[model samples]
Target chain A: MAMQERALRTRKSLIHAAAAVFAEEGYVPSSLGTISKRAGVSNGALHFHFENKRALAQAVEDEAADAVRGLVRRADRTGASALQALVDTTCGLVDSLLDDIVVRAGFQLSAERALGPEARLLRTWHEWVEQALLGAEAEGQLAPGVSPDDTAAAIVAVTVGLEVLAGVDPQWLAERRIAGFWELLLPGIATEQVLASALPEAHEGRRSEAEEA
Target chain B: MAMQERALRTRKSLIHAAAAVFAEEGYVPSSLGTISKRAGVSNGALHFHFENKRALAQAVEDEAADAVRGLVRRADRTGASALQALVDTTCGLVDSLLDDIVVRAGFQLSAERALGPEARLLRTWHEWVEQALLGAEAEGQLAPGVSPDDTAAAIVAVTVGLEVLAGVDPQWLAERRIAGFWELLLPGIATEQVLASALPEAHEGRRSEAEEA
Candidate 1:
């Protein structure tokens, strides 16, 4: 059991290291040797944990997808309204993208074909968001005329886009810009009452919390 | 003058070759040899046209920025209404992303620190859109409560988001998906007539004839 735990830890370290290297140097240039070096593991350990560079990338992507899924699940459990939960989960995911190199690289990997696990994970995440939107629509919490699928897809696209933009230019990821995004997005999907009650307060709190953290 | 024209053609070929290589192999893994070979130019000619690989990347980014700027300018001139122009220009750019390797690479390059040119171009594009939105508002084409700057930023973000999504999955780039995006987007800023006009028309002729040649 102890050995298994240590192996898992080593695997996690390798994923984190690979994500950093992928984010910085990109997938093609980042090598297994550099990833292992960053993880402080021998080549043999890396191979034991991951069969190849592609497998290592898949591991990193899986870890990120799992983390994002956990976040959405938590928000779904806690949010006051279905719409609020969807919005909160999205905002939370965007916030996570700032701090989590794994999530960031997972997203970049999803854009490329080299990482299959991340791509599946991303598709699954979208399905989750789509389910949440449908639930909200069923509850009559969504604004009239909004298609849950389209809205959910747009929300995912916007969140990823914001992360990519933020990753490239931190200045644009400022409180004002993120706030601006929500301001536009919420009006399009949220019930007016929910927008009035939930969005403004949550957005404000999120801004200060992100700044402080 | 003939020699200058020959040099210009060589430069164009180098940029085209670099774009192809970058798209296929990504930034770091793509080498100058591959680019030169693809362009059917000697290494000396590649070096003559571009100082180095990074310089070639920059040139590709610059060419893409110019193309986008040209499209925006043309849309601005041809659009019958201010809001119409904004939407037309945006959709035009998104459509262009499907085929333009330079534009595609510009987006990929925007995620890296050493590739600031793409980020700068994106920012400039955002500013131009914002200005157009403000103009639309002044022309009384926007909704009363909408903030031009915020709305413009959101629209830009959505376009970028769609492009990124399409990059990963071409299905999202389909005409139907793009139309659905506009359906969601137009309601936020457009006057009623603009919304009506923004509805996607059925295919009437060769699609590229309406925009790209």
Candidate 2:
């Protein structure tokens, strides 16, 4: 049991180190030697845990995807309206991109052309946003002229934009920037009653409460 | 005069080839040799034109920026309302991304971590959007509660998102997709009297007219 626990810790450290390198250097230029050194693990240990650079990148991507899934799941569990849950998840996502290297690296790796299309964290997030909009549509939370598909596309684009911009400057993901996005978009997509409820600021207390729990 | 024209043509060909390679392989993996061969120019000729690979990439970025600047300028010349011009410019920009390899490559290079931060096409774009929004506010085209900064951020984010997503899938920059975005945003950001005129579709004829010119 002790050995297995230590192995798990080693794997986690290796993944974290890999993400940082990949995020900073991109997937093509990053070397496993540097990753293991950064992780403070032997090259043999790194090899034992992962087959090669691709596998290590895959692991990082998987972990990041899991974090995003968990973020979306948490927002879902808040029992807020679908649009509100989406707002919360998007806000959480930008926050994660700011604070979490793994998630940031996951997104960065997905953008690498050399890495091919194996990991599609952005598409996965887009699909989730689409489903949330669909749910909102079913709940009649959407405005009369709004189509779930169109709204989802716009939301996904903005969120992806923020993610990309945040790669260069975290200010792009600042609370004010995201809140401003919602402020501009919410009124166009939600009913007047649902509008106030779905505003990004409306979920601030809920986010903290959920965080505490 | 003939020698100068030939030299200019060689430079243009080299820049185009460089943009293609950089867009496909990214800035790090892209080779000057490949770019020159693709341009059908001897590497010596390429060297005579550009100091190094970085210079070549810089030239490509410069060409792309010029195209964008021209696009924005043409939109401005249309005598459209500020918001209308902004919408038209965005739609034109997306079209250019789809049709112009240099624009695509410029954006792709801007995203590369290996290339450093000397070239910031995205920042240039964000600034342009902000200025357009400020112009809209000045023209009384913005709806109540619409702050120029916030609207500009959202517009820039969505446009950047479309550009990034289009890198993977061109469909993300499709006409319907962009039109859908303006549809969702116009109602919220443009005043009621201005909304009808600033819509993306409303500018379609104007875009072709500008294109023909």
Candidate 3:
């Protein structure tokens, strides 16, 4: 392999190792040495890719942010209803949270004490939720009497709540559970017309671009 | 003060100190020595009521459980709508989690890695939600098609998630935020009759037993 290719591979390995360690041990207890050992890379190589653990954690957060952006973009492009897009985005989100170690570590590290101001991932996620729901409201997709702001609060709370619950029980991360939230919430928020034609079931996580396209 | 009164006072002080330390520093890192120092009690006094750190944590948990039971008991006896009782109980719960150090520590400790299966406090809280919502369903206070089980799940997630958010920003625990949650949800869950008369606002936290009575 080319020298650049090998270097990139080594960097990926270190991040994977760092994410697993952070997810399990949190920020204070985890060590660079353990992350290096897990990555099967030399300590020097780990240091070469990242200056310190905080930097490594930041990289994880950036990656998670990118992953979320991808999910939202997919939802935006779909000719699906604005409400279904929101639902699909959450489905994709829970899938990433369940399947993506970097995303998990991004969140876990963001909450750690050692990296005190790094919780921007949640803030960013919240911003996306607000914007998307507002857009949906303007398009007249919302039910009568439901304010976009209040609906935003409910959606953000439940999503964050599910994330916290997932920490204790993986069962909380199931797609059906996410579906249950929308199933309960949509009736109160969406118009009858939207419900009849555009309401999606609480199944299917984020669909890939090619398939949906 | 009488000797017995003074002794009881000292015990109360010690538990308060332990809860503050545990809430800030968590289970493993907080020292009994610091708790004693904070309590302004001698080491002997600290040892008299609680044998060790774990014991001290257990005491906090027990006290928190008692406090929750008190809230629910008052709600249950008021001859109010079962749905209102659930709302008020959560209002009271958020108030305690915000203002009561022991309650906050009890929840924090329940989620600690060192405690193993000692997360009974959360399970107990979940049970109460399930039963209360179920009772409301039986009384026909619930709107048509709103399942008690799914509603219970949303309530637990939002409560736990808000508690976690409160750790970072006290704003999350504001009475309005909690009220906002219920206001958004009550419409979907409560019957029209209940909505006309019993719809909860984002106005009050847990009311005192005297006030509610």
Candidate 4:
């Protein structure tokens, strides 16, 4: 492999290892030496990719942020309505939290008081959710009595709540759970016509996969 | 004060100090020395009250649990419908989370992996919510087609999510935020007649208090 490609692979591995450690042991207790060992890289190699633990954590969060953005983009690209995209994005994000250590750790790290001001992952998710609700309102997809701002707050809470709970039990990350949230919420927030067509699929396939485990 | 009364006061102070430290620094990093110093008691006194850091954390959690039970009891005594009691209890819990250091710390500790299974505060909250929804369903207070299980899951997610978010911003714990949640949710899950009567007070009184702050 080309040196540049190998360097990139090493960098990626280091980030993943760091994320696993941070998610399990938290930011304060996680050490660079342990991360290097988990990554199967020399201490010097780890340092070459990142200057310090803080920089490494920031990189993990940035990567996770990119994943969130990608989920939103993919959801939007499906040509779904704004409300549908919001539902799809939430499901996608929860799947990422369950399957991707980096994303899980990103959220876990963001909640850590030790990380202080640099933790912006939760805020980023909240902003996107707010924007989606506003778009739905502008398109007249929302129920007449629903306030976009208030709906946004509720959606963010449910999504973040699921994320927090999933940290303790992965069942909370199931697609069906997200679908269930929309099933109850859509009737209350979507216009009659939109509610008819915008209901999220119950995600039977993915839920079965969860049950198998 | 009598000898027993003075000892009880010392124990209470020690628990409070420990909670404050644990909430700020997290479980694994919190020190018995710091808790003792913060309590304004000698290390010997702290040890006499609690055997170790783990025991001190357990005491905090137990105290917080008692407070949660108290909130439910107060709500139950209002002679409201089961659903109404659930809403009132939620509002009361959020208020307690905002004002009580011990409750806040108990929740924080419950989420920390270092504390392990002994941290049952979140589970305790989740179980109560599930029971309340089940009771609502039995009373025919729930809207047709709404599953008590699913609705309970959503409510738990929103409550836990708000509590998690409130750790970063106390505004997330505002009565208005919890009120907003119920406002959006009550319409979707309550029966027509139940919905008419069960709408959580937009909590004008509490919202104004939050606004003043």
Q: Which scores better on lDDT, 1 or 3?
A: 3
Per-residue lDDT of candidate 4, residues A58-175 (tens digit): 9998899999999999988999878888988888888999999999888877866445754599889889999999899988898666777778888888888887787678888887
Error of 4 at A176 (Å): 1.7
Residue pairs with colliding backbones in model 2 are none
**Ranked candidates, highest TM-score first:** 4, 2, 3, 1
TM-score of each: 0.84, 0.92, 0.88, 0.92
Model 2, span A5-119: residue lDDT tens: 9999999999999999988877887899999999999999999999999899888888989999999889988888888888888889888888899988888777553357543
TM-score of chain A of each: 0.86, 0.89, 0.89, 0.90
For model 2, the docking class works out as acceptable
Q: Which 10-residue window in model 1 chain B sums to the lowest lDDT?
A: B202-211
State in Å the error of residue A12, model 4: 0.4
For residue B174, model 3's alpha carbon misses the true position, in angstroms, by 1.1
Model 4: lDDT of residue A192: 65
**Residue lDDT tens for model 2, B1-213:** 999999999999999999999878778877888999999999899999999998887887778889999999999998977887888899899899889999888887775633576437877888899999989899888875577988888888888788777766878889888888887777677776774443546434423443465
Q: Against the native chain B, what TM-score does each candidate's chain B reach?
A: 0.84, 0.89, 0.89, 0.90
Which pairs of residues collide in candidate 3?
A: B179-B202
Q: Pairs clashing in candidate 4?
A: none
- lDDT (Cα atoms) of all candidates against the true structure: 0.73, 0.81, 0.77, 0.82
Model 4 CA deviation exceeding 4 Å by range: A202-213, B202-213
lDDT tens digits by residue: candidate 1, B3-67? 99999998998998898888778787889999999999999999887889989988887888898
DockQ numbers for every candidate? 0.30, 0.41, 0.30, 0.42
